[model samples]
Target: MNKIIYIGMDVHSSNFTLCSFEPGYGMSEDKIFGQVQFKDDLIKNTAKYICNLKSQRKDIDIVCGYEAGCLGYVPYRELTRSGINCKIIAPSTMAVQKGGKKLKK
Candidate 1:
């Protein structure tokens, strides 16, 4: 089976930046997925994209999370229903700084 990877996403109104991480190794290249509208092809295409990344494995486990924002829980609900482990995190609750010059996530 292909190894399960942890996915971290930087969510925005128009698009998403995703980074993949293996258990023992570091994160892979960042991938950007555009969202023309909520609850559309983006969900399906994202699932497909992840599958492609772990295609060689018999199965994969994906745990994903994004900062909770104006989009609400719709995106999280949709993704979990599709069998992906997803979480919505409050941005202010985290230590990530947005306004500072040296931004960190």
Candidate 2:
């Protein structure tokens, strides 16, 4: 069976991007599920997207990651409260290089 994962995000005021990485699938196969300008009124839509992914991929773990931004942790808290696993990534620590780059351990 093919397993799928969900990466929910509450982006900065500028833009939002969602990247989904499937196990056994290479980086080239990583899919950008969504990318668009952020809208404070769309919080409900964001929550719904996460919930839908959770429902569709019961066999796979739903791990979420979003850059730490001015929005704070309200979205993360909401996701966790709904039983989804999540992490707030430090954008400053994300490596920009491909090879020989080590991410935070």
Candidate 3:
């Protein structure tokens, strides 16, 4: 069976927090895969974790996105080379909650 897992990443200078969501009939269910910490190879470590996730599952496709800023296109290139679809989002255009909800820590 083919399944799609939506992944959102919170990226910082030295670490990245990766979370995964599965589409539900009435709502969306989510899981925190984990955080990747790196001193010099942030994108490489992140891509390794993503590939690890893919290898652990069968027939599941991943679509990952991160805000466009300091990181730039490095992430897009590495993730795409690993065969995962990636999106670099503009922070100004991303949707947010009406109330104070923490999207990233």
Candidate 4:
């Protein structure tokens, strides 16, 4: 059976903040990849990171996603070109928690 590594990205004009979640049935843990400086080949580097994870765990598949804004389709195109499954989520369609949105550690 293939396990999934779901990656969520908070992309900005100058950097990208990535977090990977591995669902352990009902006990999941999230691993933060931290902020990677934005550059011409940043998307390629992101793909390479995903590839590395795949290499370490052959039974896993990665799915990356980011909000649909600012940078536009470039990320989606690059990730797909690198053969990783990627999704672009609309901001309005996102489900918010009871407290709305908050920054907490």
* Residues 15-63, model 4: lDDT tens digits: 7767777767767654454444445567877888778878988898888
Q: Model 4: how far is 15 from its true place, Å?
A: 0.5
Report the Cα lDDT for residue 52, model 3.
86
Model 3 TM-score, 2 decimals = 0.75
For candidate 1, give the lDDT of residue 25.
41
Model 4: runs farther than 4 Å from truth?
Answer: 27-40, 102-105
Local accuracy of candidate 2 as per-residue lDDT tens digits, 1-105: 646565646476554545555554665565555444445544555656667766776776667788787878876787677776778888787766678554532
Q: Give the Cα lDDT of each candidate.
A: 0.64, 0.64, 0.76, 0.78
Query: RMSD, each candidate, Å?
Result: 5.2, 4.8, 3.1, 3.2
Ranking of models by TM-score? 4, 3, 2, 1
Off by over 4 Å in 3: 27-40, 99-105
| Stronger candidate by TM-score (3 vs 4) | 4
Model 1, span 3-83: residue lDDT tens: 556777666666666777656445654333322233336666666665666565556677778887877887688778877
Alpha-carbon error at 26 in model 2, in Å? 6.7
Best by TM-score: 4
Model 1, residue 91: C-alpha shift (Å)? 1.9
